[model samples]
Target: MATDKHCKNELAAPSADQCMDHYGCIYENNHLITLMVDPADGSIVDANRAACSFYGYRLREFRKLLITDLNGGQEDDTGSFLDRALPGGKYRGNQVFHEHHRLASGQHIDVEIHTGAMRILGRDCVYTVIHDISERMRSEKRLRESEERYRDLVELCPEAILVYSGGTILFANQRTEKLFGIVKEELLGRSIDDFFIEKPLSSSEYNKLKAMSGIKDSFRIEQRFIRRHDRRVFDLDISGVPITYNETATLQLVCRDITQKKKETERAVRLQEQRHAVGFPLEDKAVLDKLYIPANTLSGDFFIFHRISDYEVLGIIGDVAGKGISAALSISALRVMFMDSLHSGLAPVEILQDLNRRAIEHMGEDYIAGCCFHFDFNRGMMKAAAAGINEFMYKPGGGEGMRITVKGTPLGMFAGSTFEQTAIPFQAGDRFCFYSDGMELLFSSDELCREYEYLQGKIAGSVLQDDCTWLSLLIT
Candidate 1:
């Protein structure tokens, strides 16, 4: 019975050699410091070679102590590992840093302990992995401090800084929000076009920005934007820079609100209009009527009458493409060219050809349609040259009218084209009307003929709805 009892005890004990053989492979090759601890008394049950080497201890020495002996806390403290590994408790990312543990010879080493709960040997236990991250932690702290300093600098910047990514405003500085009259929360996740009253920047501008990819020379432009609070238009001078953040390309914009400047500009335009109305009266008796219509705040159509040597008069009517300030600028340039060519004593056809050549040279590719008519009263003849413009109407008596056709293309188009000059004998009570296409929309060819017949016998006032100038000369 004694032998049988000894045999049963031997069977109950685990084979140490077999257990070592099975776990030796894991102990030698594993990177993590794997350890198993007792659940009931928090004793060290088993530790791999990695754990012994990481904690500055031999496996045999570690087995002699409880898990709490290695903890920096006192023996009664129970340590954080026991608390986390209790049945039904959660194992969060709990870590302890600079924890000192004793070795066999009483030497101490600093370590970082990461703990999690698991089952070991068919019982509830705590598994821990140790790491020596003292140097890595120092590096991370320095990087975080540098980032904070850079953030502070950006916050104190005076210019309105806007950071955009993927068509949404990701970040905005205090000045940016204040200029747009919107809080940062509202501005984020919104597109730049949301506040812009004018059209968004053109595709060409966007392409140019993509090509530049850095700070460019300052360019001045007028922009219209709406405030969030009142929806009022505010002109702005905006500058932008390109930057890379988090491996993504983005744009940073700095804006200045120029509302006062816009107000001053409008006031100046009104004053100039008043001054022009006062100084330049429509006083030429040869001009029966004139009309002006601007497609926008400014016009591209221009008409002028110059009394050349009392008997001879020159009338010019022209239209440039586009609208607003660009067209206005082109018209001003054309006015200078027209006056220069006329004063040089060139014939009507020669004057138009010279003007076309100069305009093409200066404007480059953009063209304008115009007509010049010279009425030589002393010779009883009216000579006119048309370039790309519609036919001119010459009304004789008894509802008879003839159309003068253009023989050349619009100015600024071809390198060389001939302009045909047509001369008509000036008779008494002959009416000549020169106008833009805007006038033709109101009167068709048949309707104009009827009007001319009606006007042959009677003097009647006509309502012209376009930019028109009619010169009716009655030879005595």
Candidate 2:
């Protein structure tokens, strides 16, 4: 009702004919105390009837009083109020509720005031409406105390908690600030992305998280964050929770720094590497062509080539069960045992038996699939032992390819998985190819077979004769 009367007055000029109609209207007859002040001197220019009655002063007495008298002689108070309520900027809403004023009776009261600059008598002046807000101020003080108590509980929490909005850090507790090496004041206006080592997040990821169902519960993310001082790397296990503040959506982040544990893990990996280097360089002039790619940093595939005599060569290729550094070390131990047995002049079958015995002795329950061959160039014969891996192909005297079939269980798989030795005759121009499962696993079985056939056709016309290596052996 007050707003409607105010609008009518704003649309029509005041005249004697409309004076009686406006007398009891809500705008001119509101209970709020209204005052007009001269901008040049902070003097009380005019006071409405309600203002005169509310401040316990007559209109004649109020005209002689300066506006500063009601403000308890704070010299800069008037200047601050004018700056906030000038033509382009005016104080609005509850922001005006914090000002304190004294009445003519010298009794202080908390008041809510709305103010704006307006033209009066062809000169600039300020118009203000004041409302008593003593009960509202008391309620607000109690609410602030409750919030302070809750904040204290949040600060004492062990988990690192942070509140953020509009990409800026809003609030952080002691644990969070200490972990990040930042002060509360310093982090307030800074973007949260500034503390991350990687790109903060894609727009799609942000939207996905915002739209996720049941977001109030919890969610986890693994990310990299930068330390505040030296910018060192740290891994963060972040838990996000959604909250509303000031009617806007905000995120509460709980982060755990895992830098020390990560460093210890890396150190343990390097030590494992040093221990597995015990069985290096097993043979000389054997031309071992090997390519290793581990799903992890460590692998379980193993290969060894050794010369038993000046005219005889022994080759072994195997893949151990499982993966990781432990499996790789197991394969290394098996290789050492096989090399030791071969150097003692053991037959192909006996060598496999001894290797299996050693594997059973050292390995827990893991097993290895392998094939071994002893080639004698002088006698033009080859002795081979197969266990688990039996499919083989050879080209004798550079003639048509032939497949050799041998059968046995993998070593360490059973208590006594025996192996059999098979012999094959060779010629001067014969070529032999040996491989592990990884070689076939490089491409699909069909793709690899097709590539192999294509390589065979290419080799027919090529004159390149280089030492046998992984890729080079395919060329003539």
Candidate 3:
């Protein structure tokens, strides 16, 4: 019944003749926020009911406020807009302005204002319509910030990153410039295929890149690239992932320089082969047992034994400075020199002096830590000399084990560096052990064979930080 009554009232709406009487009533009751301002003094002349509600101001209060008060000083002088509203001016027609407006609650908001010059009752005025655009402005600001963060991440990445389409380069990060030895300006808009020496993208690789699958869907291959300036070819490990760049389906590539790693790997293989070829010579000697374990693919440690006579064996165990290829090379050269001195019939002390002189002349900054010894089974005597390697275990049969220490500087430090030699009588059933500093020996046990076995097992299971080599002899 109530709905019917309201419909009947709407159908009996005012006639055109009576609508003229509601001329001011329409403007006052309109839902759009509207205002009439005194153009001469920038004062508010009138405000509609919508303006009052939107600004949280009473009609009487709005009439006393200036347009600048609501505009937050955006227009310091109202003439700025009036000057543009004149004929031949930029905003001669209905003018538009984007501004920040201050609300009655002291909050600021973005707004779009549409304004027009008007005359009412023989007085000039400016009619304005305001639209709140605060939400739109906030959304645009967030989008700009997100784009800035993405650009920063790409530029600061350590590995070379690039985006390409159809073998053409679209984007390359800062690291890419350094990797290719080309400036950023030169890298852009270039063909990505030109940089690689390998064949261009394959059909399967392109298909995988276009799939736009998850991260796990990417593929990696080892490729070769030549520097733009030097033209030096180097190895690269590249991973390609399907990505959408600039709203287009494209590929993102991450490249890492693996040239040095490949060289080191090959060098290590060669060093291991050398060690295998130079196997322990005295391993067949019945009274001698030796163990050697390297810390890395290449070792700085080495041991050499030569049978000088039927009852006399000359040997040296040493460690060179540094590791990897350089140290391994040094050990290899040292072994040849040791065999020469052993065949010359030089004593342990004389051999150390000769080796020191050679090391100073040839090794340069490199140094050697070594201990040389001569074992005479028939005479029951042990003669040892020290250079950096100071102490070794010596135990007589049925006697307490003790360390024999002879002080000397490591070889190659000073020219003519003297070494100390110690002669200890070792009879049948006595045991002598020569080892590098890498091994820690207590010499608390008289049973040298058992201790040597235990040390070997322990060293085998442990992770060594340095090369460890030891030789044990049981005089029998």
Candidate 4:
């Protein structure tokens, strides 16, 4: 057995003779990739079994090559690494060098080498322990790319976003600067109390905010924000959501300016209330009951009834295909067209054709789903024509109720599209229900009161996703 001083330091045996045999056994059978190189000439002095398996080189072949041969001849070769690893021939604790090494197959891998100065049989040498770090490097690269993409999205967002902790602003997006009328450098480190008129957040309130995990769990409120430069107060809808920023729990505030929206909403409410106050033209004839629920302040669904004669009435119900103020304006135009058609004494089919033409010319790209019907009390007949508003529930006097569906293209869809008309006979005590597409009903009962209660319960239990309107008529 060969005597090596490195073993005496590592095994801590009582004497050099006792550690000689154990050192050789441990070095030859160790799992870690190990190598011993002559520091003076950079020649490979010895290699363990693990190093031979990792580099695909026999011990004899490893001994013939220099350390730089396996290191791909990088500038930080054996001599420079040894200088950094063991300055002044003394081993610096935990000195590591990150480098690339080439295998026997010419493949290269990222590695971190732990090097130390050692003496084997009175000769100076450098012992290196190598570890593969390719996977960790790839993971770090992916994390960097993901963070860059997230930063881009936050900068380009339209709404103002700010990250804060304990009422102190930590981060703010570009929109935040524009909304607050302050530069980003000035906005950061400012207190939330400076901008908002709301009460300062208590310690408990902040803890509650930090406990939130998702958008649904967040807190939202409408408040007033004062601009830092002009001190002008504006309405804002804000949401506070919990997030992790730089390994710290923080609250992110998303603020939306709603000053203009509030003004528009007030005007729309006044108009809708005035429209509702107007009397229905066919009120004296047979408007038994009605319901109108708009999803927004302005409604897209509308109904109008005009009595043509003492024994006859004309009624039309429709839904516009858009939302907001634009859809409300379309309903206004449609109401005027319906009144004009009825005054001219046009039939149901002719009235629909005329409305379709007017919709294409005046409504631009907006379309409408409408149904018009004529009731003749003396003739005991009802005639209905539809475009897009196709299905209706009809219950004859002393008969079961059935759905009446007519096939027709929506108004303003095409210039030459045709419509179909349906006619059914009815005596006294017959019931009719006309509705827009937003109303979803099972029609389980023929009575109008039961159906209306079902609809009311449905609306009460769930959030409204669209506008709904229904009209019930009874023959007397």
Cα lDDT, model 2, residue 301? 60
Candidate achieving higher lDDT, 1 or 4: 4
Model 2, 161-233: lDDT tens digits are: 7776656677788887667777766777676656654535454334423343435565677666666457777
lDDT values, one for every candidate:
0.65, 0.64, 0.75, 0.77
**Where in model 1 is the C-alpha error above 4 Å?**
1-121, 125-170, 173-287, 440-443, 446-476
lDDT tens readout by residue for model 4, 347-410? 8888888888888888888899888898887898999999989977888777777788887888
Which pairs clash (backbone N, Cα, C closer than 3 Å) in model 2? none
Ranking by TM-score: 4, 3, 1, 2
Q: Show the colliding residue pairs in model 1.
A: none
> What does candidate 1's lDDT look like per residue over 1-476, in tens digits?
99999999988856767666765686557888777777667788778877777667787877787877876545334435566455245455444434555555676655566666665345766676777665667666676777576557667988677777666787778777677777777888887667654535354444432343444454445566666457777777767666654445766666777688667546644542452233112234243533454434555667666767767777677777766556666777887888888756647898888888888889776688788888777787888888877577777755466666767677888878778888888766676666666556665554343443343322224443333322334333
Q: Clashing residue pairs, candidate 3?
A: none
TM-scores, all models, native as reference: 0.49, 0.45, 0.50, 0.68
Query: Total clashing residue pairs per candidate?
Result: 0, 0, 0, 0
Look at candidate 3 and tell me the lDDT of residue 57: 93
State residue 205's C-alpha deviation in candidate 2, in Å: 8.3
lDDT for residue 339 in candidate 2, whole number 0-100: 73
Candidate 3 lDDT over residue span 101-161, tens digit each: 8889888898888889877666778888889999989977876777577668989889899
Better of 1 and 3 by lDDT: 3
